[model samples]
Target chain A: MSTIGYKDWNVDLADVGAIYPFQGWEVAMTIVGVIFWLGWHIFQVKRESAHLEKAKQLGDHDKVHQTLERY
Target chain B: MEGNLNALTTVFTEFYYWVTVVFMFLIHVGFCMYEVAASRSRNHMHTLMKNVMIIPLVTVTFFFFGWWIYWAFPMFPFFGGLDLEAGAANLPWAETMGTNSSDRITGVFWAAFLLFSWTAASIVSGAVIERIRSSALWVHAVLIGSVFWIIDAAWGWHYGGWMVKYLGYHDAYASGVIHAIAGGYALGVIMVLGPRIGKFAPDGTPRDIPPHNPWLLAIGIFLIYTGFWGFYAACNVPIIAPEVIGGQITGITWTATNIYLAPTTLSAITFNFLMSLSGGLMAAYLVSKGDAFWTFSGGLAGIITASAGNDLYHPIQAMLVGAVGVVIVYKLHFWVEKKFKLDDAVGAVAVHGYSGVVGLIIAGFLLWGAPSSPFEGYATITPWGQAVGAVIMFFVLGFLPGWGVSKLQSKLGVLRIPEEVELQGLDYAEHHAYEDAKAEIIEADKAHLAARAT
Candidate 1:
């Protein structure tokens, strides 16, 4: 069976709409999309904070001053 | 012009393709900038010239015979003989090929395809930069642009193509037809062309060669993304009625169809495109740990990965497909680089070739049993069909011809520049001349100032 519900294009064009797969799962897909978005924020924030913490520990006074001067 | 409605439709269709052609020019501009930025200052002019020259070379060669091959070779040598009757109308000398009152669509349609040829050639140009001879690279450009890629298009991308009829090949936006073939061709060339000097260490560990100008490279990729929007549009027949298509589709409702005469919507592709790009970016950032180059290239890889089924995929599916493809491609790039010791300057093989192959196989499973064409008797989309189509695209048509040609060139001692030239850079002579000119002009200005003082 076609994943998109219709196996062929033998039907009338006026009768057709929304040929994407899993026709009745729009709500479920939206939920998944939301989860992905939320998950990304969580992951990114954690990584960024960890990275910043490491940077703060590693930065020396002279290098920071040199960087400021260069800028 | 015919009736008012017919005339309007014809003019609208012509303008649609014309606009897409104009937008697709940015892809070439982006390629030139990207190639130049990736190369060192000593090679900037040569790198830019190498990519910029692809336009006229592919353009002329495409005009000469490339367009005809698309119509004629859809089933050549295996399924049927050359469709010479259809081919005659597209020949360079044909009346419709030039300015013709009745043929409003020919020029714009030809141009849309010609731009794709340039892109295919430009992709190969990027991988072989800094070392390949201009003459050798141009020869490869013409072959890939006007010869090999078009042949794959005829087999897989054309409406009546055997791959669609028999294998159910469904690359709506040409993940395989354009990207895979070009990437595979680049791989073939680089294997023979060898790595740029200093690209490897004594122990054969690959060294990263940073871009000379990351900012230019970033802007270049962004321009490529913009041009890709036009590319998606160009792959479609903007509007057509069932009667004109003469397929199984009944009723008078006009709709846009992909190159294979399958129904889809511009709105559908739009939703999938953005979602896929986002998915690719997020995944790439995590996978490459926010490396600027891979992250930018990942966005492109994501689009290519989902493009095979973008016309039919749900937006969510597109995103996930793009994300999944990027991770796999990223891993494969490093693994292959280590194992094979082959240098691909821009990761063309991973972003385009591997993503394309993955997209096609994924489309097979996702779109399985879906009609590949609107016409009756066509095979349904299947995983095996897609897998086989990927082989034909990446290996038979793409890699073989590329390797064969490059090997022949290498045997003739003209495939790459001399070792001295490679060390000094391809633009060494030009840079010296430029410096000399600047010195001369400065001395002339000094002399003029002295005379004024006197």
Candidate 2:
């Protein structure tokens, strides 16, 4: 038994198709991947919002002036 | 496995695509250098990181679904159901997608498409640099790189796309399909994202946001030029016998064919690509009055403008088309900047979007009455058809999705960074740590000085 569904190299290559492990789980794999992708956006959006909120409270007028001056 | 001829052809095609993928990598390197050099010192690291990360993010996602989209969505929804027959061989779990000795071409061909995905995403990346939230930009990256760009490729760039069969769409080198769509997508994002604070003056005059390093910009453009050559070769089937193509042409002749199995040559494309590049550079220098950024971009614009007809154009016609297109794009860029307060950090919309649209329309007139495909019963290339194709690429597929999604994100308050973050640099800056460190260091130094005095 092979993860790739072939245990021997003697078979004709033309007869072979789907070579990756677990050949029939594409729809499930794709579903998992899509969830990961969508979940990332949700996670990133939340983290970025929190980061920005903390940054806004850092309103030091003097330091801002100094930074602006350098620019 | 099969006949020797079949094996040889398959192996050759696989090698050809593999080589194209390697060469296309330079395009990303060029964009990274170009963006970092253009951005200010404070923003360089962020700019570099933004583009560098696009490689992995796009790669993983493209492997996941982008490849499947090409095969599966060719006739999806509008014309017929998904082409599951074509898509079956490309599923990630399929043997052809991995280390199957029988099928060598599929992996490399998938990579060629993936490289194009990177290019599509990279184009959008350049236009929103220095100011866009990295998280916001990455979202745009995945959307353009893996999803939207691949869909466009299936619709127009594919050999059996509905656009090709029904609309007589002909973008031999993806002048419209990739460049236009990406540029239009960039334009859509930037319109909502706005410009850097100082990009315009109080009087509504547009100020030049110059690249910090002109030399880097120049080298970056040169690298892009090199990669463009690889892109041209990637669009062709290196060699195919007429019999194998199963077309009407009665000949034993072996020929290189465009994506649609129509004949062209490496030599013909080489002449046109360089000539067009030269034309754009010269015209951009004249038009922008030796502006370094426009001059470099002009070379890219020229190639893109001539790309649609390069498969069949006279080399001189390619040059002329490239030259004329640059002049128009250079003008439109400034006009749009002033007319609308949209801050495209780089001239991406003009370079990719305008140049692509113009090229398609020009190709329509130049290659009028020409067959769009080697397959019989397809609509012939025409001006109206080309215009429709351009709009579909730039507006329908490219701009609308980007705008709609970005608008949705904006409504959710997740599109742009907070005003405070934008004002402060988007780097590591904790409020108390630096000040506390400074105080501690000064106090310690004072004690050391007192000890020394005693």
Candidate 3:
């Protein structure tokens, strides 16, 4: 039993289409992909916000001045 | 040529592989730059030289016996005897191996595979930088580049390989065949070679050894990405007809095929490659908290992770696979470093080895039940098969040879450079000579100026 519906390559090349596994699940795969893309942005935003908040609290005046001057 | 169409196809195929070979040269260029950038100033020359020398050493040794092993050892000592009939045509003295009017594809095809051999060796070179003796590393380079990795390629990557027939192994882009085995080999050598001095504190906490030049390191990886385009192309047959393939495939439709002669398209792989790279980079950035080195390496790791199934995966599946693999590799790298105290100077083992193992297992599930080859009577792709293939690639072929040779070298007291040399840096002698030359030139210039004033 082949996941791709053909257990062997005995068929004519002209007859073969979509050799990739799970041929009918393109829509589901796309949905999962979209979720991952949107989820990444959400995760990144939250992490960045926390990082910035920590940075805002942890900055020392002298170190900040030195960093600014170096830049 | 028998016909104009046949002549054109042969010429096109020859040119295709030739172009890929030229493009793959950039991978070596990138490795040299990356190694030099990672090494401290005191060791830059030695580091560069160590990697630079792998090209010729591996090339010569590969020519001598490596290419023959691929054809001959596809089933030796396991499923059957050596394929002497097939191997004869690829022998070093074989007329086809050299310039012949009838055979145009041999040189370029050999070069394409030779570049992969160099890459396998280079991956190990990166992990053992700074502390390893150049002589010792060269021996490892020859072994991995010519002997061990090629054996894995014969078993898993070849069209008629036993692994593909029996285990349904499907590493379309060498996630395990090249990257995993090389990475595992690096792990074996490093476990015996030990970490650079001061890499760990008395309390056993690992310290960060930042790259000396981050810009060069960045450019180096980018070049590798560029060369990877060629690598992906090289893995393919470019173009072939079903009649020539002589497999179960029927009809006259000509198509591109993976190493296994399975149907795929360059367009499909292109989409998957870019998506997987993006996934790896994004995940690495988040996981490493935007650390530059890890982020860059993550892009590579991502590609390696998705590569096993990239030939058939949807672009989105490719991306997710890459991202997921990077996260696991990143976490595992640090975990192993802490737990085992194994110092991977450039994360070669995790980025290549662990990523490869993960990609193969993932491909097993994602591409499960897919035909491993276009040939009849082959096993279908399965998670169990891929897992076993990963073990054989990573542990059996990769780690064992590396560890055994390194152990012998260690006992002989030749595996690593002297402790003094490591502390002072591998390029100490060269640095002293450079400084002396500068001082002598400055003194002479001063003397000439004084005479002119007088």
Candidate 4:
């Protein structure tokens, strides 16, 4: 019982399509991946809002001036 | 595999794309250096980090889903549903995506496209510096790099893409697929994100916000030019048989083909690339009155403008076309900035966006009556087709989705940094902690010095 259908290299290469593992689970895996990609955008945007709220109150007049001077 | 000839062809093609990927990586390195140099000193590290992080973020997400989208999405909405048969094997968890002796080409081919992914994100990064939240920018990066641009590639750049087959789309070098979309998306985001403070006077007259280190920006663009040589090579199929391509060319000769299996050559592209670059730089220097940054970026914009037709254009035509496009793009960039009150920090909208649109239109007219595909009965290149192609690229695929998403974020008050924060600069969000630590350490140093003096 191989994780792949066959554990042997004796098979013809033309017959071999996908060779990794968990062969029949591609659809399920893709669903999970889509969730991750979309979820990331939601999470990131929220975290950015929170960070900006804090950043708005963080730096003083001197530091702000220093940043402008760099320009 | 098949016969000895087949084996050699597969291996050679694989190595060709692999080499191109290495060369294309320099484009990102150049972008990082350019952004760091263009940004102010206090904001320098954050700017560099914003561009640098795009590599891993786009790479991982591209591996995860972007590659699959290219295969699955080709005819997805307009022509038909997803091509599930081709896309199944490309799924992230599919064995072929990883190390497998059976599949030799998928890894390298995926990487070539991934490099394009990096370029798309990097183009957006340059436009929204010093003010955009890193987290917000990265979201745009991934969306543009891993998602939106690949969909454009599937629709327009792919061999079986509906745009190629139906609209007779002929973007041989991603003039619209990568560059145009990135530029449009950058424009859309900036429209919602607003200009950096002090970018304009109270009277709405735009001021020139010059690059902090023009020298580094120059070198950065030069490196991009070098990497562009590889990008041009990556767009071609190095060699293939008529049998494999299932095309009508009655020849035993194995030759280099463009993305569509139409005949072209490395020699032809090489001549066009250098001439186009020359045309762009020469025009930029003259147009900008020797302004260093625009002139350098002109070299890049020139290549992008001519890229759509470089596969077929005579070298001089490519040069002339690039030169003409740069002049128009340069003038339009400033005009649009003043008219719309939009601030694009690095001319991403003009260089990549407008040049790409103009390139597509120019190719249509120049290469008119030329077959868009090797396949029989496909539409030929025409002025109307290219104009339609440009609209789809710049507005539908590029701008609309960008505007819609950014609008959502803005409504949530998540699009732009707050007024106080924008005034303070995004760097302070990361720098204040450093300042606190520095203050603590300095107090200790002063005490030690006092003791020693006593």
In the range B207-287, model 2's lDDT, one tens digit per residue, is 887899999988898888888899999999999877777754445677787887777778879988998898798778767
Q: Arrange candidates by lDDT, highest first: which order?
A: 3, 1, 4, 2
Cα lDDT tens digits for candidate 1, B218-325: 999999998998999999999998888999998789999999988999998899888899899988988898899999999999999999999999999999899999
Task: Find the candidate with the highest TM-score and give its number.
Answer: 1
Local error of candidate 2 at residue B159 (angstroms):
1.7
Cα shift from native, residue B120, model 3 (Å): 0.3
Q: CAPRI band of model 3?
A: medium
lDDT of 4 by residue, B1-454 (tens): 5889878888998999999999998999899989988888768878999999999999999999999999999999988999998999999999999899889999999999999999999998999898887788888889999899999899889879898888889899988988889889998888988898899999999988888998899889988988889999999999876666676555455667788877677888998899889889877876786688999999999999999988877666677788889999999999999999999999999999999999999988877766677677667777788889898888887888778878888787777767786666667767888899999999999999999999
TM-score of chain A of each: 0.88, 0.86, 0.87, 0.82
Where's the lowest-lDDT run of ten residues in candidate 1 chain B? B281-290
DockQ of each: 0.80, 0.01, 0.71, 0.01
**Candidate 1: misplaced stretches above 4 Å?**
A59-65
- Candidate 1 residue B21 C-alpha distance from true site, Å: 0.4
Per-model TM-score versus the true fold: 0.98, 0.82, 0.97, 0.84
1 or 2, which is superior by lDDT?
1
Clashing pairs in 4: A20-B95
